[model samples]
Target: MTPVDTVDLWVIPLDRPGDETRTAPHLDCRESARADGLAPPRRGRFVVARGATREILSGYTGVEPKGLVWRVGQWGKPYVELRQDTAPVPAFNLSHCGAVAVLAVLRNGRREVGADIERVVGGRAERLVERFFHPDEARYVRGFAPAGREAEATRLWTRKEAYAKASGHRLLDVLHMPVLAPRPGRRPGRGDGTDTGAVRRLRDVPFDDGWAVSVAVMGSADFDVAPRLWPEGP
Candidate 1:
């Protein structure tokens, strides 16, 4: 069997009290949160998410979470910035929804990573597809039985968002782009389309209780993903 690159995914619960204490020392993170002008609860979520991200990255780099520097791309993607002599940096991305946050870490710093978690709620799935999905994707969603349409739409939406995040593109930029269905058991190097050289894969995060989470990684190397809930404690 071909060796696959691996990524570590950490899922964190925002409701925990310890998250605050763990992340509070990162004053820069707090400044960013305060700048958002979000309400208290929303700001709290931001603090936890930002803290979790730093804590996770620090675990791998041995750098204090607050000491790590970041650079944002023109399109709003954020990545760690490392000095030339610094040890290999890891690529990471963060996403949160409802009461949870997901952080994806790619050891190969050259690769790009993106993640998104969405709460599943009742809505007019068909109408949403028409508004947000690519023309072909919308038709594909509609083809599903009405009963399954919403689930299918949610899955595809995650896929689309994941891809956009990995590519460092905004969701709006790729909403209309064609997304190929995932192929099972395919070799890692196989190209699905014109962009085959970049490894792109999406996996369902087994989130119970009405949540959908997906992570996307893009690079030349094939990767395996290991997902785990954040361990208790700071």
Candidate 2:
């Protein structure tokens, strides 16, 4: 496991050929039931996402992927229920969009982390900005060139999403949270409606084409985000 100062980000391709066949065997009964509830394409994606989550967590915990137990929070976030004797129980969060899934793990200790990925699509941003985004963030997206609005909106959306997940709050509840560094000297967190006392750090994660990714970590100090492709070694 890595140090708490670094958050490991794993990029997983949900539609990769043969991934489902290989990872399906590791799903617990609950995960299997959830996967079974989904329709095609989505079902396949769910299987790949959860299965890969197990495989990735297994690397750090030494627990077989299927053996890892999960508990759900009141807000619907999933937590890995490790033994009290376990030396390092990593905090993690996962998000997926289109064909890609991203997982963030803060290893060697419990530190809240969240990740979000979204396909860059046009036209959806304008209305979402009007309804969900904080005024400052909406202005930021609108300030972008007409052609750049969608990408900027996607970036802002991912940041808001990552922050929500990191704080274990619902998206709608935190939709008013401003994620941008509003002015030159100002940082993004305080006065952004964060009721949680933990300080939040947000950053954009570089990944493959057609996707925008971002990660959020809650701590007083900043943490480096180490990104890597899934099914690959440390």
Best by lDDT: 2
**Model 2 bad stretches (over 4 Å):** 1-4, 182-193
Q: In candidate 1, which residue ranges exceed 4 Å CA deviation?
A: 29-36, 180-199, 232-234
Give the clashing residue pairs of candidate 2, or none: none
Model 2 worst lDDT window (10 residues): 184-193
What TM-score quantifies how close candidate 1 is to the native fold? 0.84
lDDT of 2 by residue, 88-165 (tens): 688999998877789999886556888899888876865698677878778777787898888778877888899889
Worst-scoring 10-residue span by lDDT in model 1: 184-193
Q: TM per model?
A: 0.84, 0.90
Model 2 scores a C-alpha lDDT of 0.82
Quote the lDDT for 194 in model 1.
26
What is the per-residue lDDT of model 1 for residues 23-97, given as tens digits with 9 covering 90 to 100?
A: 767648545758368776777788788877877887878788788787889888888776545667898888888
Which candidate gets the maximum TM-score versus the true structure? 2
